[model samples]
Target: MVVNEEGDILLVKNPNRGWEFPGGYVDKEETLQHAATREVREESGIEIQVTDLVGVEQISSKRLNVFVFKGRPISGELSLSNETWDVGYFTRGESLSKIKLERYKERLLRCMDEQNTPFLLES
Candidate 1:
């Protein structure tokens, strides 16, 4: 999930779930990075670069592995698809309450931990 320069986190509302980050299962022969970028674009119509693999979530019931990646918006305007009912950026605190599921809210908070981002070295 990507946050803007103002520190607002991006969120997409799924029909089953309330508000969550844009993501889905990685397709066959497709790269994880590509999948992350594509999911965000398809759901929010925003281009983003996958910056880091922040965390991994396992859905025991579905036996699914969700790779949570942090990203930054590269380009494109906000647009919605059938996958998402709404798309927008929200403050860190707002996100805590805006998300319906408790675990989903935890995931958003975890991504906000900036230490996950590796610092680039400079000579």
Candidate 2:
């Protein structure tokens, strides 16, 4: 997931309930890093530079690759695409309730808890 200089985490409000990180399934030819960057731009109008791999989670049937990125809002105003209804930033506490996926909240908390160090996972 990507966070901008304002200390707000980027979130896409899914139809389900809460908001979500702007990312989707990886394309066949694209690398994971590129996929993350593309998905962020497509979902939210902001351009980002991915910096690090944060953590990974294996859900019931899906393998999720989560990356922690320190990015700047280089260009584009916020626009809601087909994948999202609202696109905005939220503080860590605000994100817990704002994020639609429980797993996402958990991951964010994990990242926050490990702020001083870096986290990496395989598989």
Best by TM-score: 1
Clashes per candidate, residues 3 or more apart or on different chains: 0, 2
Tens-place lDDT digits, model 2, residues 8-56: 7888887765587787778899888788888888989888887766665
Query: Which portions of model 2 show Cα errors greater than 4 Å?
Result: 63-70, 115-123
Whole-model lDDT for model 2 versus the true structure?
Answer: 0.73
Clashing residue pairs found in predicted model 2? 18-100, 19-100
lDDT of 2 at 59: 46
Q: For candidate 1, which ten residues in a row score worst on lDDT?
A: 114-123
Query: RMSD, model 2, all Cα superposed?
Result: 2.6
**Per-prediction RMSD in angstroms?**
6.0, 2.6
Which pairs clash (backbone N, Cα, C closer than 3 Å) in model 1? none
User: lDDT of model 2 at residue 96?
Assistant: 81
